[model samples]
Target chain A: MNDIVLNVSNIGKHFGGLQALENVNLQIEAGKTHAIIGPNGAGKSTLLNVCVGRIKPDTGSVKFLGDNLTGRKPHEINQLGVARVFQTPEIFPELTLLRNVMVPAFAKREGAFKLNAFRKVDNEAEVRDEAEHILEDVGLKEQMNGLAGSLSRGDKRRLELAMCLIQHPKLLLLDEPTAGMSRHDTNRTIDLLRLIKERGMTKVIIEHDMHVVFSLADHISVLAQGQIIVEGSPDMVRGNARVQEAYLGGAHV
Target chain B: MAQLWHRNDLLLMGVFTLAVLAMPLWLAPFGAGYPDLLQKLAIYGIFAIGFNILFGLTGYLSFGHAAFLGVGSYAAVWSFKLFTMNVLPAVLFGTLLAGVFAALIGFISLRRSGIYFSILTLAFAQMSYNLAYSVLTPITNGETGLQLTQSDPRIIDRLYVEATSGLPSTELFGLKMSGYPGFYFCAAILIIAFFFSVRIFNSPFGVKLLAIKSNQTRMGYTGYNTRPYLLVAFVISGMYAGLAGSLLAVTDPLAGAERMQWTASGEVVLMTILGGAGTLIGPLLGAGLIKYFENVFSAYNEAVLHQIFAMLPDWLQSAMVFVVNPFVGEGWHLTLGALFVLIVIFLPGGIMEGIRRLSSLVRRIIARSRRDGLQAA
Candidate 1:
C-alpha cells in the first residue's frame, strides 16, 4: 500500500445550525488521485477549505506527512508544499501570465518572506525559465506575455492549474477545477488531469461532474448532506445503493 | 559589448544628476531659480516619491503621512538644540524617529484596509497634531514652534572649535545650508531617494506589493505574509517623509505644529495623483507643477495680468483680465481645482496617462501617413 500523504480525522464544522462538515474522516494515499463527489450544498467546498486552512473546523485535526495543519494560516499551509487551485481561478489579473506563474514560483523558492529589494527579478534566470516551462507544459506559452485577466475562462483555469503545478507540491487540492466549462473544455481538463496523474503527484479533487469523477478517481467518496455515504472504487461507487438513494436518486428526481 | 550607461541603474542616476545640476539654469526662466523655491521643490518631490511606494504601488492610500513629516521636523529641531548645527545628525534623528512612529501606527492601522485604514491613519495624525499643539507644548513649543536660540548648548561645536558667529546656521562640514549650496545639498539627497525608489519598483519586493494590491486574499493563500510587507512599506515611506521634513528644517530651521495638519497630507496625495501615482517621474512632476503654480502663478495679480495684455485694446484687455481673474492670484486654487476636475473627467490615469495617450495618438497618425505614402509610391 502507498504511504498516506494526507490524513483527516473527526473533522466537523458548523455554520449556525447548518452542518457544513460532520465527522469527516479521509486518508489520501501518495501518488493517487482521490475525488470527492457530492450534490450542491453537500459540504465539498467546506471540507476542501478546511484542509487548505481557509476555515477552521469546529473539531478535528488535519495531518500531512505527520505535521498538524489545524489553525495554520493559508500561507503557512501553502509553504508546507500544499498548493490549492481555486474554483474561479484566483490569479493576479493585472500582471502578465508569465508573472502570474512567477509569483508562486518566487513564494515556493524564497519561502514566506525575503527582502530582495536591490536585486532585479529578471536576474533570476532559473525562476523565469521554470515559469516559462510550466506555461509551455500547460500550452499557454504563446500567450505568456498576455495579461492574465484578459484570458478566456478556459485559459484562465489552465493558467491557474499551471501556477499550482509549478510549486511541485507534495499534495495538490483542486476545488472544482472545471466548474464553468463547456463539454469540450471539460474533456480537455480531464485529459490534463490524466497527464498530471502520470507524474505521480497526489491530488484531492472536489468535483460534481460524474464523468470526470469516474475518469480520474482511483478512489471515490460520495458525500451528501455533510457526510460521506460510501467510499469505493469507481465500479463499486457506481453500484452502491446508499449513494444512489442520497445523491444519484436526488439528481434523477 | 553593452554600454555601461545602458544599464537602468546607471541611466537613472545619470538623468537624475543632470536634472539636479541644471536646476539653476532651467528654473531661472520661470523666476524660480532662487534657493527658497528650489529647496521646496526638492523637499516636496522626496515627500511625494516616498508616498507613492505605499499608495501608488500597494494601493494603500495613507491620509496621515504629514504627521511623520511633522515628527521628523520636531526630531531634527531637537537634534539641532542638543547636538551641533550640522544637518547630518538632524536628518538621521528625524528619519529614525519617523520610522519608529510609522511602525507603531502602521502595526495598528494595517489591521484594517481600504477606507478604514485611511481613517485610522487620519485619526492618529489628528491626535498627534492636537498633542503637539496642546499637551506637548513643552516639547513642541505650542503655536510658536521650535527654533534654535543662542542660549541652547551646541555641545559638539563648542567642544570641538571656537564659536565665531552670533547664531549658528545649519551646515555640513562648514558648508552653510543656505542659498544655492543648500538647494544643491537637498537636490543630491533627492537623487539618492529617487534611485532607491526605482530599485524598489523593479525588485521582487515591488512585484509582491503589486500582488497585494491585486488581491490580498490570494496573496495570503500564495504563502506570503502580507502584513510585514505592508508595515515595512509604511515605515519606509514615513522615513522618506521624515527625510523631507528634515531637509525643510535644515534649510529654514523651524518645526511647526501646523506642518502636521491634514491639509499638508492631502497636498502630497494630490501631488501623487495629479502626476500619475504608479509612474516613476509622475510624483516629481506633480510636486514641481503644484509648487510652481503656488509660488509663481499666485504672484500674478490683476496688475501683472493687465500689463501682459497692455498691447491689446483697453476693452479687450479688461475682458481678458476678467476672464482670467478667477484662475490666478488669490484665485489660483480655483484654477487648480478646475484642472484636477478636467484631468479626472478625461484622463483618469492622471498627467502621465494623458502623455501616454497623446504620444500613442501621434504614433498612430505618423504610421498611417507613412502607409499612405508607401501606397502612393
Candidate 2:
C-alpha cells in the first residue's frame, strides 16, 4: 500500500442510462507493469479514463502519489506526472516527428504555462538532442524530421512511447497500445515495453491481447461488465475459472 | 543546421522587405502606385498577417478580429486627441489596448472551440460594433467617427506648436506623414511585423500552437495547460491588428465605427484563406489583392472601359464595355468573389499553393533540360 503509485477506489461512472464503469477499485504499485485485460465493451478504457481524469466518476476518487486527481483537469493531472497514451495513437499529425517528441518535453519542463514565445525552437539545443536521443532509442531516429502523420501504425506507437519517455513521467497509462499490431510488431513492442520496464517507471496497460498480458504484467486484473471480476499474478489469472469465464464464457472455463 | 534555419529565415525577411518596399514602382502600371493606395496595402497587410497567427497556427478562427483593428484605430485617434500627435504613443497605445481586449475576449471564447468558438468571437465583435455605433457614441463619435479636432488638447502638440488654425495630421519626429512618406511609415511597420511573425513560426510556443490545432487532446495530456498558449496567441494577434488599425489612423487621421462591422471582420478571414492561411507571406498577398480590387478596380466604369477599348472599332469598343460591365466599378465584389471561388477550387492552399506548384513545375522542366544537356555533352 505504501508503494502504490496509483490508487483508484470505488470508481463508478454511467453514460446516459448505460453503466460504463461500476465500482472499480485498482491499485498499481510503483515500479511494476500492471495489465488490465477485458473483452470488448468491458469498461477497461473507462477505468483508465477515470484514473487520468478524462471522466469524472459518478462516485469514488483516484489518487496519484498521494495527490487527489479525481476533480483535476486532464492536463493538471498530467503535470503531476501521469501520462496517457490513447487507444488510438493521438499525435500531432501536422508536425515533424522530432517536434511531436519535443512538444511534450517543453510542457514537462515549463509546466502548465510559460510565455516562452521568443526562444527559437531550434535553439532549445538540450531538448532537441534529448528528443533525437529518445527517437534513437525507439528506432525512430531515422525518421525524426518527417511528419508524424506519415508513420506506419507500429512506428506511431513507438513514437508515442518515445513521447512519453521524454516526459520521464512517474506513471504511464497506455490504452490498447498494441491493439492493431501484427505479430512481429507486437513482439517488437513487447520487447520495447520490457526495455522500459527496467527503468522502473510504473505502467498500467489496458489490453485485449492475452500474450502481451502474460509476457509483461507483474499483476493482472480481469475486467467484465464494468467490474473487476478476478485479479492476481499472470499464472494465477491464467488458471482462474472466473478469468476464463470473463474472457471466453462458462464453456471455455 | 540552426545557422542554416536562421539564414533561411533572414532570407525570407529580406525578400519580403524588398517586395513590400518596391510596391509603389511595381504597382504603378496597375494604377495602384499612389500614396493612399500604397499605404492601404501596407496597413491591411499588417491586419491580415496578424489574423493569420491565430486563425492559421492555432486554427481558432476568430471572427471578431476586426474588432481589435477597429479598437486599435479608435485608441490611436484618442491617443492623438489626448496624449500626443506623435506616432509612437498612438501605435503603442493602440496595440496595447487591442491586446488587452483580446485577452478578455479570448478568455471567454476559447472556452469553446471550432464553430462554437467562432460564434462566440463573432457575437463579441458584433456587440462591440453595435455598441460603438449606437450606445458608446460619445467615445466612438458614432457615424461621424472619431476624428482629430482643431480644439483637441493634445499635450505634446500644444507644447510644440504656437499657432493652431488648421487641422494637423499625425507625424513622426519632424517628417510629415502624407503621400510617399506615409506609405514608407506603414511599410516600415509591416516589415517589422513580418519579421516578428517569422520568429514566432520557428519558436517552441508556435509549435505548441500547431500541436493544439492538430491534436488538442494530445497536447493537454502532454502536460500543457493549452488555455494559456491559446490566450497568448489571441492577445498577440489582437495586438497586431491593433497596430495595423493605428497605422490606418496615423496616415489618414480618422477612426470610423464602419471599420468594426462584421463585414470588416469577415474581410480579414477572406484575405487569410485567399492568400494562404499558414504561410508567412500569404496573408500579405491576400490583403494586397483584396485592397487593390476594392480601391483600383472599383474606380473603373463604362467610361474607363470604353477608353481602354478605344483603339478598336466603334462596335467592338461598345461590345467590350458591355462585356466588362459587371466586373468592375460598383461590381468589384463580384470580381473578388469569383476570384475567391477560383482560387479555392484550383488551389486549396490559396495563392501560396499555386506559387509552390508553379515553382516545382519550373524546377522539373529545368532538371529535365539539364539532364538532356549533360547527355549531349
Candidate 3:
C-alpha cells in the first residue's frame, strides 16, 4: 500500500444544533487522487475546511505526515506543505496574475513570515522566475500581467491552481476545481489534474460532477448526509448499493 | 552607474534631496521661505509619510495617531529638561516612547478590525488627551505645556560650557536648532524618513502589507501572520509621528496638551488623502499645501484681497471679494473642506491620481499629434 499523506479519523463537527460532519474518516494516500463525492449537504466542504484548519472539528484528529493538524491555523497548515484551492478563487483582485502567484512563492521561500523590509521584491529573481514558470505551466503567461480579477471564471480557477502548484505542496486540497465551467473548461481542468497527478502529488478533490470524479479519482468516497456510505475504487463505488440508494439514484450518473 | 541612478528609489531620493535642500529658494516665491513654516512642512511631512506606511498600504485608518505625536513632544521636552538641551536625545527618547505607546494601543486595538479598530484608536487618543490635560498634569505641565527653564540642570551642556543665555534654546553640538538650521535639520530627517518609506513600499514586507490590504483572509490562508505585520506598521507610524513631534519641540522647545487633540490627528489624515495616500510623494505635497493655506492664505484679509483685485472694475472687485471671502482668512477651513469634497468626488485617488490622469491625457494628446504630423509628412 502507498504511504498515507493525510489521515483524518473519527472527525465530528457541529454548528449549534446542526451536525455539519459526523464520524468522518478519510485516509488520502500519497501519489493518488481521492475524490469525495456527495449531494449538496453531504459535508464535503466542511471536511475540507477541517482538513485545511479553516474550521475546528469538535472531535477526533487530523494527522498529515505524522503531524497533528487539529486546531492549527489555516496558514500554519499551508506552511506545512498543504495548499488549498477554494470553492471560488480567493485571489488578490487588484494585483497582477504574476503577483497573485508570487505571494505564495514568497510565503514558501520566507517561511510563514519574515521582516525583509530593506530588500527589493524584484531583486528576488529566482522566485519571480518560478512564479513565471508556474503561470506558463497553467497557460496564463499571456494574461500574467493582467489583473487577476479581470480573468474569466475559468482563468481565475486556473490562476488559483497555479498559485497552489507553485508552492510545490506535498498535499493539495481542491474544493471543486471546475464548479462553474463549461464542458470544454472542465475537460481542460481534468487534463491539468492529470498532469499534476503524473508528477505523483497527492490530492483530495471535493467535486459534484460524476464525470470529473470518475475521470480523475483513483479512489472514491461516497458521502451522504455528513457520513461516508462507501469508500473504494471507481468501479466498486459505482456498484455500491448503499451509494446508489443514498445519492446516485436520483442523478443520471 | 546609470542603472544605479535609474532605480526608482534612488531617483526618488535624489529628487527629494534636491527639493528639500533648495526649499529656501523655491519657497521664497510662495512667501513661505521663513524657518517656522518650512520646519512645520518637514515635520508634518514625516508624520504623514509614517502614517501612510500603515493607512496607505495596509488600509488601516488610525484615528488616534496624534496621541503619539503628543507623547513624542512631551518626551522630547522632558529630555531637554532632565538630560540635556541637545535635539538628538530629545528626538530619540520621543520616538522610542511613542513606539512603546503605539505597541500598547495597537496590541489591543488590532483585535478588532475596520471601524471598530478606528474607534478604539480614537478612544485611546481621547483618553491620552484628557489625561494629559488633567490627571497627567504633573508630567505634561497641564495646558501651559512643558517648557525649558534657566534653572534646569544642563548636565551635558555644562560639561562643554557655562550657561551663556538665560534660556538655552535647543542645539545640535554648538549649532543652534532655530531659524534656518532648525529647518535644515528637520528637512534632513524628512528626507531620511521618506527614503525609509520608499524602501518599505518596495520591499517584500511592503507587498505583504498590500496583500493584507487586498485580502486579509487570503493572506492568512497563504500562511502569513498578518497581526504582527499590522502592529509593526502601527508602531513604525507612531514612531514617525513621535519624530515629527520631537522636531516640533526642537524648533520651538514647548510641548502642549493641544498637540494630542483629535483635530491634529485628523489633519494628518487630510494630508494623506489630499496628496494621495499610497504614493511616496503625495503626503509631502499634501502637508506643504495644507500648511501653506493655513499660514499664508489665512493671512490674506479684505485689504490684501482688494489690493489684488485693484486692476479689475469696482463692481467686479467687490463681487470677487464676496465670492472668495468664505474661502480665505478666517474662512480658510471652508476652502479646505470644499477642496476635500471636490477631490473625493472627482479624484477619489487624490492629488497623485489627478497628476497621473493629467499626464496620461497629455501623453495621449502628444501621441495623436505626432501621428498627425507623420501623416502630413
Candidate 4:
C-alpha cells in the first residue's frame, strides 16, 4: 500500500444544532486523486475545511503525514505542504497574473515573512523566472502582465491554480475547480488536472460534476446527510444502490 | 519592451522632489518664512504616508495611529534625557518602542478586522492617553508636557557653543544645526521612509497585503496566515509613525499627551484619503494640503484681509469678502469640511488619482491628434 498521507477518523462537526459533518472517516494515500461527491448539505466543503484546519471538527482526529492537523492554523498546514483553491477563484485582483503567482512563491522563499526592503523585486530574477515558468505551465504566459481581475472566469481559475502550483504543495485541495465553466473550459480544466496528476500530485477534489469525478478520481466517496454513504473505486460506487439513490438520483449506469 | 519602472510616476516624483528641495533656497530671499512651513509640511507628510500604508493598502483604517506617534515622541524624549543626544539613538528607541506597542495592539486588534479592529485600537490609544496624562505623570510630565529644564544635566549638550537669544542650541559637533539643520535632518529621514515604503509597495509582501485587503478568507484558504501578515504590516506602519513622532520631538524637544489623541489619529487618515490612499505621493500631498491650511489660512486674520480690501472699491470688496468668508474667514473648518466631502464624492481616489486621470486624458487627446494627422496623410 502507498503511504497514507491523510488519516481522518470519526470526525463530527456541527453548526449550533445542525450537524454539518458527522462520523466521517477517510484515508488518502500519496499521489492519489480522492474525490468527495455529495448532495448540497453532504459536508464535502466542511470536510475539506476540517482537513485543512480552516474549521475545527467537534469530534475528530485528522493526521496529515504523521502530523496532527486538527485545530492547526490554515497557514501552518499550508507550511507543511497543503494548499487550497477556493470555489469562487480568489485572486489578487489589482496585481498582474504573474505577480499573483509570485506571492506564495515569495512567501515560501522568504519563510513566511521577509524584510528585503532595500532589494528591488525586479532584481530577484530567480523568483520571477520561476513564476513565469509556472505561468507558462498554466498556459498564462501571454497574459502574464494582465491584471488578474480582467481575466475570464476560467482564466482566473487557472491563475489561482498556478498560484498554488508555485508553492509546490504536497497535498492540493481543490473546491469546485470547474464550477460555472462551459464544456470547453471544463474540459481544459480536466486536462489541467490530468497534467497535474501526471506530475504525481496528491489531490483531494470536492466536485459536483460527475464527469470530473469519474474522469480523475482514484477513489470515490459518496456523502449524504453529513456522512459517507459509499466509498470505493468508481466502478464499485457506480453500482452501489444507496449511492445511486441518495447521490446520483438513480441515474448512474 | 514593457518597462518595469513606471516612467511617468518616477518623472513626476523627481520633479516634485526637486521643487520641494529648491523651495527653501527660493524662499531664502523672502527672509526665512517659507522653510518653516515647508518643514512642517514634510514632517506631517511622513506621518500621513505611514498611515496610508495601513489604511490604504491593507484597508485597516486605524483611528489610533497617533498613539504610536506619541509613544515614539516619549521614547525619543527619554532617550535625550538619559542617554546621548546624538539623535540616532533617540530615533531608534522611538521606533523600537512604537513597534513593541504596535505588536501588543496588533495582536489583540488584528483578531477582529474592519470596524471592530478600529474600535479596539481606538480604545487602547485612549487608555494610553489617559495613562500618559495622569498615571504616568512623572515620566510624561502630565499637562505641562516634556521639556528640557535648566536643572537637567546634559552629557552631550554642547553647552560651549554660543546660543541664539531666544532659541536653545540643538547642536551637533559645535555647530548650530537646530532650525535649518533640523529641517534638513527631518527631510533626509522622510526620504528614507519614502524609499522604504516604495520598496514594500512593489514587493510580494505588498501584493499579499493587498490580497488580504481584498479577500482575507481567500488568502487564508490559499495557505496564508492573514493574521501574522496583518500584524507585521501594522507594526511596520506603527514604526513609521514613531519615526515621524521622534522627528517632531527632535525638531522641537517636547512631547505632549494631546499628540496621542483620537482626533490626531483621524487627521492622518484624512490626509491619506484626501491626498490618495494607495498612491505614494498622495499622502505627502494630503499632509501638505492640511498643514498649509492649518498654518497659513489660520494665520490670515481680519487685519490681513483688511490690507487686501483697502485696494478695492467698498461695494466690490464687500462682495469679495462675502464670497471668501465661508472658505477663508471665520468658517475655516466649514471650508475643510466641504473640501473633505467634495474629495470623497468627486475625487474618491484622492488628488494623486485626479492627477493620473488628467494626465491619461491628455495623453489620449495627444494620441488621437497624431492618429488623425496620420490618417489625413
Top of the candidates by lDDT: 3
Q: What is the lDDT of residue B58 in candidate 1?
A: 92
**What TM-score does model 2 achieve against the real structure?**
0.97
lDDT of 1 by residue, A1-253 (tens): 5799999999999999999889999999999999998788999989989988999999999999998999999999999989898888899898899989999999998988888888777776788899999998888999999999999987899888998998999999998888888898889889888988999999999888788888899998888889888998888988888888778775531
Across A50-133, the per-residue lDDT of candidate 3 in tens digits comes to: 988989999999999999999999889999999999998988887889889999899998888798898887787788899999
Model 4 clash tally, residue pairs: 0
Give stretches of model 1 more than 4 Å off. Answer: A249-253, B1-6
Error of 4 at B91 (Å): 3.3
TM-scores of all models? 0.96, 0.97, 0.97, 0.92
The best candidate in terms of DockQ: 2
Ranking by DockQ: 2, 3, 1, 4
In terms of docking quality, how is candidate 2 classified? Answer: high
Which runs in model 4 stand beyond 4 Å of their true positions? A250-253, B1-17, B25-33, B79-86, B158-167, B306-313
lDDT per residue for candidate 4 within B83-184, as digits (tens), equals: 545688888999999999999999999989899999999999999999999999999999999876654555555354332344353444445447777777
- Which residue pairs in model 1 clash with each other? none
Expressed as tens digits, the lDDT of each residue in B57-119 for candidate 2 is 999999999899999999999999997888989999999999999999999999999999999
Candidate 4 docking band: acceptable
Ranking by TM-score: 2, 3, 1, 4
Off by over 4 Å in 2: A249-253, B374-377
Error of 4 at B22 (Å): 1.6
* lDDT (tens digit, per residue) of candidate 1 on B1-377: 12442386687789788988789889999898899999999999999999999998899999999999999999999999888899999999999999999999999999999999999999999999999999999999999999998887878888987777577899999999999899999999999999899889878899889888887888888889899999999999999999999999999889999999999999999899899998899988889889988998899999999999999999999999999988999999888888778877887788999899999999999999999999999
